[model samples]
Target chain A: MRIRKLIPGVDANLLIKDAGKLMQDPMRRSFLRGAASLGALAFLTGCDIIDGDAAEGVLRKISELIDGAQAALVSRTKLAPTLKESDITRPFPFNAYYTEDEAPAVDPATYRLEVSGLVDNKKPWTLDELHALPEVSQITRHVCVEGWSAIGSWQGAQLSEFLKRIGADTRAKYIWFKCAEGYTNTIDMPTALHPQTQMTFKFDNKILPRAYGFPMKIRMPTKLGYKNPKYVVAMEVTNTDHGGYWENQGYNWFGGL
Target chain B: MTAETMTASQDAPIHPGWVRICHWINALAILVMIGSGWQIFNASPLFDFTFPRSIALGQWLGGAIQWHFAAMWVLVINGAVYVTLGIVTGRFRRKLLPIYPRDVVADAKAALTFKLAHDDLAHYNAVQKLLYAGVIIVAVIVVLSGLAIWKPVQFQELTALFGGYDFARYVHFAAMAAIVSFLVVHVALALIVPKSIRAMIAGR
Candidate 1:
């Protein structure tokens, strides 16, 4: 065979001779054994060649090598402390709660989001009523459990406004968001009133389309897309914990980015 | 010399020096990759927002990626060299091929039933050939899927090949698991057939 040229011939006599040589030469045997040991060691350590870097110094380097790699790593690492700080990490898709019907179209005239639930002063406010309050806009990423993401600028009323206006009960532990389409998603009060969470009416400098909830939407940058429900119809302050649609579908309810 | 002596003299050694080197190197590379990869896949390490802990595992995402990418280059290059040498020297034809399906099935049955004991290196039985082929093919898939995920925006078609980025990633991880399992079996067989390891190193 062609490979025979690369090594010596293998006759029965040769095989016996080779065995004798290995047995007789304890030093050579030990050396070969050492090589084998190193091979095993390499496997356990996940040798450098598998890692792509050949240089000994570069092998131990932890920092990113390329600019793009640096950018990607830094961006991902810096995005949120919640991911690193949160005690829980789930691997299922997030499921938010919602009624099985389309949200009612906003009747700008008679439309007023009813702020009830655990609030002391339950009242209804017109679209103008909410818009008349201070608004804040910020560009942030919407993380999805499906392993996709998008960044968009969101504009709306600070959730703190409604919480303060309705005089939320200090004992309330969760916030239930009732959408115009009867979609409901509940969140921890602290998470709901997070500075980043808002009752958004505009996205990317344009009024959200009906599909995206024309009159109003909820933006929770730290949560998955499912947690940020659209067509928010009402706000309910509650002490009991509840899940959204995707949550019931075996998805993580928190949906933190 | 007698006819028996002449016949014994005619049998060539099973493993060659180049092939042995390539095999051992690849083994070493895979070990490092798996260990580091486990560490890196853990970054962010969650399925969605609500539940926690998908499979009971650890987080080593950064470490895994770093080690994974590094090992990837090695596996690719070493495999490339091995294939090139195999083709150039016709070693592949002599040992890997000419393995008829009937013979392969026979050998596989023998191997599975433990009828073939260790040190029986009569031209790499059919199962070995299939395993060799599988490793090569799966290695290629791992690299391609890896590229797709590593640069999803740039390698759109590659990502689409194994489904979208999410599905492609799942495939990539699954392939890694398969290769690791194969490695375990390969190693066990090598230990049982100790002569095989000796032959690999001594080129006998």
Candidate 2:
């Protein structure tokens, strides 16, 4: 605290020597690094709330302005957050899903994603059976709403393959994925079948992390992290609509960033 | 008047114009990075490892990335140049050599107290020395954590340094806060002692 008052003109030379002393000390360097890191985290915590409030205010004003206008840009009944492609799956920088679970004992020879919605056919094709149909692979970035992202190559069968196999009903508009963890998320059918969207079984040139939905995980290159449900277990083709876990918690259903 | 100030300025000038330029330029780069970094941080609010602040909006998140990446290059390159020059020219040893143990302990009091604020460009007071070293070290951590988050695949080991992506991000944020605090104090001192600020700008 005493150094707080050291005005430069008083002792320029001594100040330089003192600086030299501090720099030469290893213990001092470590202390300063650790201390600075702490300080930055504390400040970030405080600022988060302030910015969140500002965002809420902006959203409200936008909604109010729309209500007051004669020719509203979007109908009140149809006013929903913009559906950006990037919002499908956001990535977290360090949340790698690590699991040691072996591939399911369910023999791949007989395992198949049962496509049963408004579809015409309701058959379960084996792994080879599905692979016999077609393969889909894509390299895309997974953007997490928590402010982290990663790009990886994903390879698997296309969701539309199963949909077409079962003969998807013409009226079905949403594709819901049921994960092994009982987590469920849905995306518009067209978006689900986008070229970049894949029902990936391999990640980064390796077998998928079991925790990452080893058998399969939905990869929506454009959405936020949460939207890409891991450990996917089931698929539901539906005409109705619903949101994922985080989505119901006030998070954007389509987190593009 | 203070012994600390008298002793510091007693010796011949040690900080040359080049050294001074490097010093202030480093500070400028850091300040811009911190300010813009804050604007970008607000996008995803995390605190105390608790719940996240939900309200978030910013297209400037991308802008933040640009500013940070740009400022980072400046900090890294300038810092590298400064260190290289210091070592090559023996300026590091000549200007930064520590005083004896007795004087360090004795003057440590005045140095800590800034009772030695009589001259401009006296190099760095004991506390200033500590702080300057500190800011540089923190800047290093910022770069490391940044790399971890930026190219996780390519720098998987680097990412592991901060416990992974989320933690690396946390570390990066924390480093910024520390640097900002140092900057705040630096500015306050400059304003409090106009002579120092003038020296920095006019290069006396």
Candidate 3:
């Protein structure tokens, strides 16, 4: 093999001698006894080990299977563990692909939550109207895909209640979010209706700071940090899979973790 | 010597088919998992430093995650099969078990004093048995800690057992470090006793 030349000081004679010894080993003969059965099992499974692309396709299929299995296993009614006020991570670290200074500044006066797709009421909601609805608060952990977590109290209207008022088609498979910072993402409908899924407007009993996605952020404690959209300006309920910002780039769509 | 004479001399049964297959598969899976895990860890850079991108697989975080999850299935399934077969085939009892406290103490003394018993290359020594058993327990901890972090809400009990989300991450990272340490010792030992490496591969 061409790769053999890459090793600096390996003796070909010694290697050949080792191979000769291995072939002569009686244990090798016994181990090979099950080789026929293994070959049959491989053939029965219809796996083409020789085709590289087909192997990759099989891996992708398995990934999709895992996603489907995770989705099926998740309980919509189960709430994420809530934390005490004292447990809230102080100064909740700002996380985004960009630095803190680059956070998008959206004007509250002109900020309108746009509603579209698979909904009877397509009316845009202002900040006041969103706050007017019955509100809930939760101190839940925000789990990042990067292996860090922080707890922060978030106050917002229930996403389900908002969907109800907006006359969104609850039967839709996905609810997509368009953020002012140019981030786009989608979540499964069941996750959207999860009790902990909130259309958060307040952080720590105050107006959400710019670093924390002021105006609105979708808080999904049941999911990883990326699944939750910040600076959300538009939402679309639809059966089509819109795929998220990170998700489209190979992150699992069903990021229920 | 003729081929028949050579075959007769070298023909000693060592590892079974299942053990050899699972061992290689597990080694490959762990390597991929660790490399990709380093890439994933680079995203947030736990502590003040980041894992060097040059040594890690999957340059992008998303790609790293895909690799991690994919290799995770191999690790889980292969590990399960190996453990189950070890128990069912009585390999655990015959080969791994039967280590007494005195045997372990004597083995440790010999090992520390640089007097390894190389006479029985076919069987595991007391220290080898204990280390292997310890690694298996560590593997279980790694898997459980991984699940706790992966699905904290669903596996809330596991998260609590680890003390919380942050502590779970700590445990997972610590377990990975322990596995790496084990690998270092294992490779060193293999190099010291090349016959055992041949025995593992050729099963004699």
The lDDT for every candidate, in the order shown, is 0.60, 0.55, 0.79
DockQ of each: 0.02, 0.04, 0.17
* Candidate 1 lDDT tens digits, A102-211: 33567767777888778888878788878877888767645444334444666887787768877998468788887765667887666666777788887656776564
Best candidate, DockQ: 3
After superposition, candidate 3 runs with Cα above 4 Å error: A1-62, B1-12, B112-114
lDDT of 2 by residue, B1-204 (tens): 698887866553445677788887787567546644654565444442211212111223332343455556677889888888978998756655553555556556875676665564656555665666677679789878876765444455676778866688889988877887887898887798787766666655
Which stretches of candidate 1 lie above 4 Å from their native place?
A: A1-257, B1-13, B44-59, B98-100, B117-122
Could you give the candidate ranking by DockQ, starting with the highest? Answer: 3, 2, 1
The interface RMSD value for candidate 1 stands at 18.6
Which candidate should be chosen as best, given lDDT against the real structure? 3
lDDT: the better of candidates 1 and 2: 1
Flag the better candidate by lDDT, 2 or 3.
3
* Candidate 3 per-residue C-alpha lDDT over A1-257 given as tens digits, one digit per residue, 9 for 90 to 100: 22221112222233333234333434322221222132212342433532334533454566678898887887766779998999998878777765566789999999999999999999999999999989899999998776767889999999999999989899989999999989999998999988889999999999999989998999999999889999999999999998877775456778887
